[model samples]
Target: MRYDLKVPFAEKDQAKKLGARWDAARKRWYIDEGLDPADFARWQPAPHDASSAAVSAPASRRAAPAGSEGTVQVGSRFVELPRMCDCLPWEDCDACRLQAWPK
Candidate 1:
C-alpha cells in the first residue's frame, strides 16, 4: 500500500524519504522507517492477509514513522519528543542552526 501523508513541520521532509503512501481503503497513510532518505525514497506495504483484517506495521514503524515525534534507532529505544519552538525540535537555540535542522 502506498499511502500519501500530510507531514506536519515537526516530521520534516524526512517524510519524503519514507515515501509515505496513502491507502484509500483505510483512509490513512503509511511510512517505512527502515528507509534512510539519504539513500532511498519508496516502499510498499506487505500484502494484507485477507484472512485477517488486522493491520500491523512493524513495532518500530508503528512507534515512530517520523523522527519529529522523536526517534528510536532500530526501535530499541525511543528519543524524547522535541520541545515546542519555531524550529523543528522546538528547542531554544540559534535560529540559524534550528532552521537548518528540518522544515
Candidate 2:
C-alpha cells in the first residue's frame, strides 16, 4: 500500500531526501511498499479514526510490517534498523550510535 504524507511545502526537500516521492497529480508526497513508514513519521498524516491510532504511534513503539524481514528501503539502499541506532535513515549512523550508547 502507498502511504501518503502530510508534508509541508518548506519541508519538501527534507522529505525527498528521506525517500518520499512527489505525486504531481495529487500534489502530495508518498512512500511505496518496502519503504518503512517509520522513516517518514514526522510527516505521517494525522489519524482520523480509532484504528488509525497505530499509524500515529512513534516508530520505536511500532512493529515492522509483515513480510519486511527486518529491513526497509530508504532512497536507493537497504538498511538494518535492528543493527543500527533507531535514528532516521538520513542521520549519521556513527553519530546516532554515539548518542544511543554514550559512555
Candidate 3:
C-alpha cells in the first residue's frame, strides 16, 4: 500500500529553521547566503491559463487572497507568476501537474 504523508512548514517558523526571511514586497521567501541579496529568491510558479492561483501552496500560508479567476498565490508571498513547470520554474502548474495522472 502507498503511504501518503503530509508535512507542515510555517512561514516565519520555516524562515527561522531554514535561516531565511519572507520578503513581502515580492511575496517570496529568501535565506541569507552571505552573497548577493537578489540571489535568494523564492520558487517560481507554474505556467497556466490566468485562471487561478499561480502554484498551489498550503492554504494556511498568509498571502494575497484571490479575487478573480485569474492566477494567484496560495501561501507564498514572493512567488513569481507566468510560471511554467516544464519551462523554467515550475515544470507544470498545479492544475497541469494534477491532470498529468496515469492514463
Candidate 4:
C-alpha cells in the first residue's frame, strides 16, 4: 500500500530530495513502495481504515480544536498528532497547501 506523508511546506524541497512524490489530485506527498517509512516517519499518515465510521466523518466534524493535540492510529502504531501551519487563511502559500488543516 502507498502511504501519504504529511510533509510540511518548509520541508517540501527536502522531501523531494529524499524521493517523495506529490499527488496533485489528493494534494499530498507519498513515498513509493520499498522506501523505508522510518526515514519519513513524521509525514506518515495515521492508520485508519477508510471504511471505518470515525474516518468517514465530514471534514468539519473530524477537525481537532485549535491548540489541541490528538492521536491517530497508523498501521497498528500510533504517532504524535500532525501539526498544521499557523498561517491561517492559508493564502495559497505552499506550506498551507501541503497541510491537512483543521476545518
Candidate 5:
C-alpha cells in the first residue's frame, strides 16, 4: 500500500514540505499508506505501459527448465545445481541470499 515518489533532487525540499518520507533503504521518496496520491501527482512514477513486454525475471535468477538441473564444472566433475528463484535483484525473498550483497 506504500506509494513511492519520484521527486527530483532539485525539488526535494518541495516534496519534504508536502509530507513525503525518504526511504533510505530503497533510496526513494514515498508517501505513507492512507495518504492521498492526488496530492503527490507531480512526483508519482509514470504508469506502466501495457504495450511493453513484461519481464518474467532477471537473467541471473531465472529458473532452469522443468525437470532439468544446471551443472557447473567443479575441478574435475560437473556439479548439479538447483534452479534459482526469480526474485528482484534488489530485493530478497525467504529463499535467496540476496540480502547479503550490498545494495
Candidate 6:
C-alpha cells in the first residue's frame, strides 16, 4: 500500500533521506513503493489500518452544530484551528489583529 506522510517543514530533509518524495501539488511527502514505511512512521498521517479504512470509505460532508468549535478532519487527522480565530468576519479583535493578512 502507498502512504503519504506528513513531513513537517523543518523535517523535510529527514523524510527525504528516508526515501520519501515530494508531491509538490499536494504539498506532502509520499513513500516510494518498496520503501519500508516503518522508517517514516512518525510522519504517517494516520495508523496504517486507519488510512486504509478512510480511503475505502465514501466521503460525505455534514454541517457542524451551531456554536460548535472544534477541529476539522482533513485527510487522516483533525486540522487544528486557533481558539479565537474562526476565519469569519475579520473584525478588530486580538486574534484578527495578530493574523498575518496578505498585503
Q: For model 2, how many clashes?
A: 0
**lDDT on C-alpha atoms for all candidate structures:** 0.47, 0.76, 0.42, 0.69, 0.71, 0.68
Model 5 error, position 99 (Å):
35
Worst 10 residues of 1 by lDDT: 37-46
Which scores higher on TM-score, 4 or 5? 5
lDDT tens digits, residues 7-97, model 6?
A: 7899999888777888776566787678987898788776553433312423445566776558654776666656556656655676676
lDDT for residue 18 in candidate 4, whole number 0-100: 85
Clash pairs of candidate 6?
none
Candidate 6 segments exceeding 4 Å error: 47-103
C-alpha lDDT of candidate 6 relative to the true structure: 0.68
Per-residue C-alpha lDDT of model 3 across residues 1-103, encoded as one tens digit per residue: 1111111254456434544555455455444435342332333222452312423456576575567447754775676455334544445567656655536
Model 2 CA RMSD to the hidden true structure, in angstroms? 18.5
The TM-score values for the models, in the order shown, are: 0.21, 0.46, 0.22, 0.43, 0.48, 0.44
Q: Judged by lDDT, which candidate is best?
A: 2
Q: State residue 80's C-alpha deviation in candidate 6, in Å.
A: 42
Candidate structures ordered by lDDT, highest first? 2, 5, 4, 6, 1, 3
Per-residue error for 91 in candidate 6, Å, reads: 43
TM-score of 4: 0.43
* Model 6 quality (TM-score): 0.44
Model 5 ranges off by over 4 Å: 49-103
Q: Which ten contiguous residues of candidate 6 have the minimum total lDDT?
A: 49-58
Residue-level lDDT tens digits of model 1 in 71-102 = 53466575666454455554557864655477
State in Å the error of residue 93, model 4.
Answer: 50
Candidate 4 regions off by >4 Å?
47-103
Model 4 lDDT, full chain set: 0.69
State residue 77's C-alpha deviation in candidate 2, in Å: 61
